[model samples]
Target: LNPEARAFDASFEVLSVEEAVRVTGRYAPLADAVRELIEATILTEVDGGVVDNARAAIEGVTESLRQRTRSAKVSYRVDGRPLPLGNAAVGVCNPIAPPIVVHQEGGGRCWSEFVLGLAYEGPPGLVHGGVSALVLDHMLGEAASEGLSKARFTGTITVKYLRGTPLGPLRSEAWIERHEGVKVFARGTISDAAGVTVEADGVFIEPAWARDGQ
Candidate 1:
């Protein structure tokens, strides 16, 4: 890590990350708004001409931005982790993320929260099964590496869909169950207002670089 990125105090790092999160998070609502419009258009009785015009307008804007950013990709690192500015998925700071937006609520478990919407829908009004797995995967991996200096990668994960995950506010959690050599055992679940919907178990492995003290 460069000295400049590492020099900030822990408190300053936290605040800086928070500011970045807030600033980058502003785009999420815009994406969400567009998502809602898409869903509405799917069922709307509006004429085809109007829809075509709207689509063209949106495409023009997208193209303009793409051209403006024709340069090479920009990346930032903080506290040894990659910055999440333009991550298409799993980036809480990215507007386009379906963002499971996990937070460490306490010591024993890793908890995350998000509300599924049309953009993540499958099976008509229900959260997609694959999306559920994606959330659990990330939460479980984080749990497996909790309090460790090294990061863990998913070796294998098994998920059981207990019930249909509804499209609304939901929470997921994971905790380390045990460890065997380089592998960490973990379990996690997704829950809605009704109750637990999806459960998962996985083995997460400390990657080679981290284990080698990189």
Candidate 2:
């Protein structure tokens, strides 16, 4: 393990990789079901009765789950260790997250492949610009962390949308460009079969907490 990563881990409650997988896996199906429901709600034209029935069922489930809500968020391993189950971008248990699975390639690079359904649609079958930015931001931060071998937070990110990103299968790639002191600079792109549609550059900074631990 990278020394920096190990040091950072010392500051948080670390769970066994198996436990993380099991916990995330337990929720994975629920997330997928919700994703399907979202897409279906957007695309399907149902009667008022059907809509009311669905709404009532969902409300019941929500109330039941609310009874078991945690009082505080747990600080668990995120940066490619086990799984970031609560992450908004790449969490398997997050229903709102696109189906993005990030893979760390050699030489400070990270890649993700995913598909966007109707729930992410904007501008008539195209992906929203903000959604593109969100994906790039997370990808660039992952690259920065991989480059520095430590967790990093987004300092600033600039995204350029070259063309309309269609709502469907897409790929993103990010890599570290350089680092200075506690900041890592990274670049990334979202591409389709034709070519790149979005590009981004970002600076990631080591948080004060992690730096203090070091």
Candidate 3:
């Protein structure tokens, strides 16, 4: 074993790809957000029947942008900051991103501000409960990956609703919580213009596919 690579911590119950997808979707709101993000950002106007196909399109766009725009770095700084195009596209697939303003990014972390459209509304005027989870998951997942590196993907997530998150003018933040070797944890929150409304915790696994990258 290459001891320098990753010191063993604890092993978790490995969920098959299908099982993992199913488990995540149990929070239906998160699932829907993922679907939206995929359709809007990753796939763009192109219609691809499968996830991998969409990923390919995302890669093409990002690579093209990098090649055309970057100086010596082979990657241009969008909005005065490096943008992992594919990653951001994948990140925004979350319906929670809504159509609003994403803050100019810095380092590995990013923040977004937007209003929840009617499509995402739940509980009278408030955003749907699932939608909140979806937002947290998306941001947390992005934070887990940071830039260039693709995260293993979320394994488990724990969220505290706190107070009902409102639908409009919300701000969200994402950052890495901690990493126990292959497992990455991140924290994030949804807040109205007034104050924090909900908080979340996510456990992202550096899956075997990404182990080589680590």
Candidate 4:
């Protein structure tokens, strides 16, 4: 089986897909509310009293959450099946993760469609350069691993900014160019309706732990 399909099948052994969806569904609304709060914090022009009240309300929620025991793992999961909760780019349960879902596009390609809001603004209405890099890095790494078929981490990545990436709807695509031994080389681009605004190339390598397992 292809790497991606194998990974999916493996997930079922730990947590059925239906249960995974149910768990994530519970967290999704909370994450969305926090995401909206981020945008409102960036764009809202309310009075000081309103801001103070909002702060107090948020602090109360934070304190309540803190009272609960925290999980040791950085990422959330159901049994051994990993969830993208803490992922910075496309995590549905990560409030700070941009509103994007990266999906495989057959072959070794991966694609994402997303929109950046005021919370991600940089350079007066443009998406932050660092954010672009984060997304590209994630996409390139996904392609390199064939959507997590094999465990890999980025060894090197080079991004070239062709133009300003606007703070709105955008498209990202990445594909594996080739693989050599434990190394995979990939290329990717971020584009708006006008055209490509950022392009990147990266090399990903299997870590020692993963290689040893093989």
Candidate 5:
């Protein structure tokens, strides 16, 4: 490999298939528990006494975990491990997430499905605008690289709110419109039972390795 190729190789760390499998088995359930806890906390309306008791219990659990772990590790999508179970935001293994589900439809297109609970509420029965954007951004970013290359960073995204996205099972999709060099243009949509509620256009920059074919 030449210097340019070396740059790409040095930039990323890829773990062996065996190690990734073990990590996923160990952490996946723990992340699911955490996600459930987050949702419970958001919707709970317990009595004051119960709230206080719960808080104390939570503090004790936190302290116990603190003694075992130092800090959070930043985990990105790995080459062989297509499921990003370790991502902090929207990762299936992360409790602090909406944990959107994604499917690659091939041909630079992707599909996502998720249900937003009360924690994501914005207007009285509607999903928050920011939450909508987050989902769109995630979906579009995935679509931009689907069935294509691996540069998947969003440069910019513009969203249009056509109607209120209700709180329940929702669908999102995105497909690449075009690509110029390292830049990809993509379009995405969020819809509920009634129809499309939000639409977005985004620009995703492929990773440096993909650009140089390293």
Candidate 6:
């Protein structure tokens, strides 16, 4: 490949098809679970009927996923916070959305924030590497799922740990890089009083099934 092409490819942080397949397998169940919530809510007596059903479905899926996948999780929507789960990043953040806010997009791009707690320890008083990755993944994933771009799961994510994250308050941010066909590309990072501890790049897929308008 030419230097320009190589630079573009290098900039992408692309993954192999096999790698994409593997990630799809890992996250497909989560997507399906969300669909189930949408289906089940069809019969619920929501106030706005259609829109209310959609909200219930979204909230239900987030709650269900939080319960099953999160370790120690706490979440809140417009309503209020719910029972906390263990080891959950959102649960730890104390501001995570229950119906899993896809996309840090409350209003627009550039989503960011921080957290500090006892559980996310690594070196002395630093946050753990895995914990940093988890937070970045969810933040990136949220941006992916945002209505602006219909990204499903991360096809690939590359993270760099530039420094040790402090155990105190931390900040995180995620935003869309671009979109190609059914793929939505995004980037995110986590930082703290010390500095930028982690940087992340992600490719999110809209999924084959989602194309059917599901």
Off by over 4 Å in 4: 1-13, 72-81
The CA lDDT of each predicted structure is 0.72, 0.82, 0.62, 0.83, 0.77, 0.59
Model 5 agreement with the true structure over 101-135: per-residue lDDT tens digits: 77888888988788888778999889999999988
Q: Candidate 1 vs candidate 2: which has greater lDDT?
A: 2
- Measured against the true structure, the TM-scores of the candidates, in listed sequence, are 0.78, 0.88, 0.53, 0.88, 0.81, 0.52
Candidate 3, residue 207: CA error in Å?
1.0
Q: Which ten residues in a row have the lowest lDDT in candidate 6?
A: 78-87
State the local distance difference test value for candidate 4: 0.83
Q: Which of 1 and 2 is ahead in TM-score?
A: 2
Score candidate 5 by TM-score against the native.
Answer: 0.81
Clashing pairs in 2: none
Name model 6 segments beyond 4 Å from true. Answer: 1-87, 91-110, 147-151
Segments of candidate 5 deviating more than 4 angstroms:
1-18, 70-83, 86-89, 147-149, 207-214
Work out candidate 4's RMSD over C-alphas: 4.9
Tens-place lDDT per residue, model 2, 1-214, is 4455465453344777787778777888889998998888878788999999999999999898788754244446644453566567887878999858888897779998899877877799899898899999989988998833576989999999999999899999999999899998999999998999999999999876577764
In order, how many clashes per candidate? 1, 0, 1, 0, 2, 16
lDDT (10s digit) by residue, model 1, range 48-69: 8988998899899778767644
Which model, 1 or 6, shows the larger lDDT?
Answer: 1
Q: Which regions of candidate 2 are displaced past 4 Å?
A: 1-12, 78-82, 147-149
Give the clashing residue pairs of candidate 5, or none. Answer: 151-206, 151-207
Error of 6 at 90 (Å): 2.1
